[model samples]
Target chain A: MGTEDDVTPVARPGRPYDRSRDAQILAVTLDALAEREYEHVTIDAVAQRAGRAKTTLYRRWPTKVDLVLAAVEAAGRPPEADELPDEGTLRADLLAVVDSPWLGGPERRLAIFTGLTSAARSSDRLADAVRTTVTEPYVAVYRALLQRAVDRGQVAAELAPRVPLLAQVIPAMSGHRLGATGEPAGREFFVSVVDQVVLPALAHPPGPATPA
Target chain B: MGTEDDVTPVARPGRPYDRSRDAQILAVTLDALAEREYEHVTIDAVAQRAGRAKTTLYRRWPTKVDLVLAAVEAAGRPPEADELPDEGTLRADLLAVVDSPWLGGPERRLAIFTGLTSAARSSDRLADAVRTTVTEPYVAVYRALLQRAVDRGQVAAELAPRVPLLAQVIPAMSGHRLGATGEPAGREFFVSVVDQVVLPALAHPPGPATPA
Candidate 1:
């Protein structure tokens, strides 16, 4: 439904690319994703919401996948610092990740998650974006947490390789539930994951170190 | 792409609804979903692939979500017997579910999964289909397995309510990995889930009957 009438000039040309407008487009795009399902959302809708031209959005992101990926990559900014406060045991540390505002809790995060999975299934750009922007940073935090647990003798050294995949579990589970209900998973759901899944996986007894 | 030239007209009315044509449509739809990502896939495309008119396919399923849901429900028919061989422990039972041919292995299953998750985010019909066709049955089998584990005192009786969510863990993990790599998670990935995630979550020291 893009018409010339719908195309608002994004400021006269040569007037500094207006980085704020790009940010505005990304923000509206994310809001659109959160408010509607991926397939139902359109770039025209985003442009309308952002008060920009469809041509302006098309110039930056040629397709919906490109736009969605840019938004997801934009949303997944690494926390300013890596060293978390000593949250006592590994359970608390892991729980802190879940409890954190950023780690897959918000409605917008779910939107990015749903879009990422759908796009990454076919697009290499999104797949790489998922790996670099979403996967690696999350895994790094998990690895560091598990190492701390190992040093404290809470988790076994043998479970090292397996710990990284654990990083994906809670987010995946939350993402799964969110797809159905369009709401972030509750605290109880996360508590079950930590109490039942993560801690259980790592509770290797101290005797006869069985290699994981 | 759907054209009268390509259309294989369904048998005229009063004759049985071409049951085989229905099957062909479902099969081609599944193929279409696997061959392309969810958004790019269309009813016309599926109809074209099945060599049937779009009207014929539309008669059976009104919208793309309906068509996709039908294809998913068709793909996920769990053969009626549920009495699993008691593999002596919860670990073995869980492994059997993961190892089952119908569970987490097929390309069509992944396609259905991707399509369902993508569509379900907004459509209640797709969401319910996913819960019933995709999530519940799998959860039922897992609940049965865990029940057996509890019967043998291998699992904590207190963890019953949480068991169903645990059932989602393996499929969710595999789904996440599949979305990125577009490949079914290998045997090793399922194994890690059972060992590291499920087992640990249920690992209660066989001491007192402490209620969870």
Candidate 2:
């Protein structure tokens, strides 16, 4: 259900955008996010921490979700384009994601994502930003991996329509589970995720997208 | 990392336990949880909203996780077991979950789960509570579904270790995606989830719990 006159505020061009202030706000927001789960964080606290008045914060962020989203996007280090692996098989390429430092090491990213999702239950725009900024990197890697797989004919060309679901589910499940439980997404979880979930879906021939 | 040598303050038995007070606090916490994402909510705020002293809130809850867990447990409507579908095959029984109103309805439950998980990134007890209380109902249904499948010889024995992963991943993906994107976990999504991820894992021959 959509709400409010607008979920995101348009920049009024009232003042020049200050990159330094942007960075500071994000840094403070990230600290606050790390300190407490998203539900406990307040824009006022973030503003207080950043040494910016609430108006200064709102001028750019427009909404609390926008502010938090910007912070999380900044905190997350996107995989470098050069870092994309071209290991021969589709499996090896996808394994790069499994083995990637970006996805595996930090507890913070998962925590941040989970926190946004909890809020996203009510805010549609927050969810969009998450998908675009946070969910996009892995999705890009998955898309590349799948494109390579399809190019090699390792998977049927027909699997294309369903790639949206397939791409993010791994990161979504793995990250969410770890974020929620403090359990490391150990090698075992990754391997089973690949073998039991990802691979199986690919192997099964597709019918109509809708299930009976 | 363990924090203050003593975070959870023990009760002094100075007064009798007030069940009504306990209910009021939980109701307030649940409302707070429903109103905002977990990271943004604070104990002080919850206390203020509940019109209770912080000491009184802490006397019962001890930790933030403890308070939130109690609220979520209270808010989630326990599945009316009679509602479980007994369709002949395991798949049908499991499908009942996708069709169930509890998972599909208002965003509160998913919000509660996501918030708990975000905190759970740090708190082991909170994680246990989430899996135990929030995830347990579905896990139980999945266990029943799998037992029926194993009994019918529709699937092999070794799939047991992986059921935990299989059962929750759908809700995790679907709910997280919706929460983040404001998109519905459409029937098509549910159909694809079962077809692509779940059925294949079951059909694949059992191997060691961890992938080689």
Candidate 3:
């Protein structure tokens, strides 16, 4: 009677199954999230809204947090390392990343951020996924960029080895959206920070890095 | 009988009922926070622990959120505009603030941060105060420091002018603690960020400011 059975890939023969059905379910999850807070949104309600059987929803995601996280993931992939800009300079690369339209806007990012934080507090598995999938990957790309600068002798060899890459970028980018009334980061802001602040601290004159 | 009153300033006698006793009450509120989570902590519990009357606590704060906020305020002020380090350079100054010992260690900051975010979800006043008093002060100091740089012709012209600076330093400083793994900010790490990442980004020559 419904598209549920058709969309949901059935499990092998007698085994449990469904792939396309899961996608529809995840889409419905997003719709439900928009309509209600994460705490109030439930699996039964999601199934009801999707017009799918309750068992189908449970089979895909074990819990509401898992479902919510899956929906977030479905919204977009993390900015891939290769997708990062490298215009032969660090400043330009940072600006590109900061201003990328594909990246979720401040409001959406804030929602994901708060959701991640809450899920982390409530469940360890979600925390692990966030660290491995989101935090670490982005940090690695920046660290790689810094490493390239260090290799080119554009920055002090010691600088890239020690800096907390994620710490520097995330704060400036997320500050305002996270309820800070500060000026939002943009191309000039990114460039200024890179040129005025980052480069000076890192450009060792072919000597030992000084004590901070 | 209680030292809470002694440690905290007393209310004035006549002109108006001094709100100073609220400070005393909040001190005890912090003591309670150290022992319990936000859900478990209560205003009556705070009054009982402080040896102050419940009516006195209610008269000043009126709600649990207000009481907790007063405790946060009484804990100490955020870094002041003048207090931002001025070691003849912006990089050193920023490193000082990020690595300041008086700001409380990472764990304590995380606790306060988590508590505040959790409270803010439900209470508008708490949310506003967290943004205004705690978050804005730090952002303002950063903006002021950047403004000083701009004045020195060390940074770009037309930088976004605002009371709360949006350049990302605040988030970069706090992100690690608030995020999943919750790492602490250290002096050397901060210096590297200020030097390699932050200084270059903010400097005028658009290159490294100091030799690494």
Worst lDDT 10-window in candidate 2 chain A: A1-10
Residue B23, candidate 1: Cα error in Å is 4.2
lDDT of 2 by residue, A104-201 (tens): 23455444455665554435566566667666677677766776677777778876655666777777677557545645465556666766566556
Query: What is the TM-score of each predicted model, taking all chains together?
Result: 0.67, 0.56, 0.64
Candidate 2's error at B43, in angstroms? 24
lDDT of model 3 at residue A89? 62
Tell me the tens digit of each residue's lDDT in model 3 across B1-212: 12233235555667456655665676566656544556778899888888888897788778898888766666554545547677766665665565555435444554555566545545667767777766666767777777776786656565434212234555455545445344434444455445545555543222235522
Task: Give the Å shift of residue B73 in candidate 3.
Answer: 4.9
Question: Scored by Cα lDDT, where does model 3 land?
Answer: 0.57
Cα lDDT for residue A55, candidate 3? 82
Off by over 4 Å in 2: A1-36, A39-69, A73-77, A80-84, A98-127, A156-162, A175-188, A204-212, B1-86, B96-135, B180-183, B186-188, B204-212
**Residue A181 error, candidate 2, Å:** 3.3
- Candidate no. 1 TM-score: 0.67
- The most accurate candidate by lDDT is 1
Q: Residue by residue across B55-114, what tens digits does model 1's lDDT show?
A: 998888888888877676666544312557466666766666655555234444555466
Interface RMSD, every prediction, one decimal place? 3.7, 4.5, 5.2
Every model's DockQ: 0.33, 0.20, 0.24
CAPRI-style quality class for the chain A–B interface of candidate 1: acceptable
Quote model 2's iRMS. Answer: 4.5
lDDT of 2 by residue, B31-130 (tens): 6765665677788899998899999888888878888877755555336343567765555555566556563344554444455545544455666666
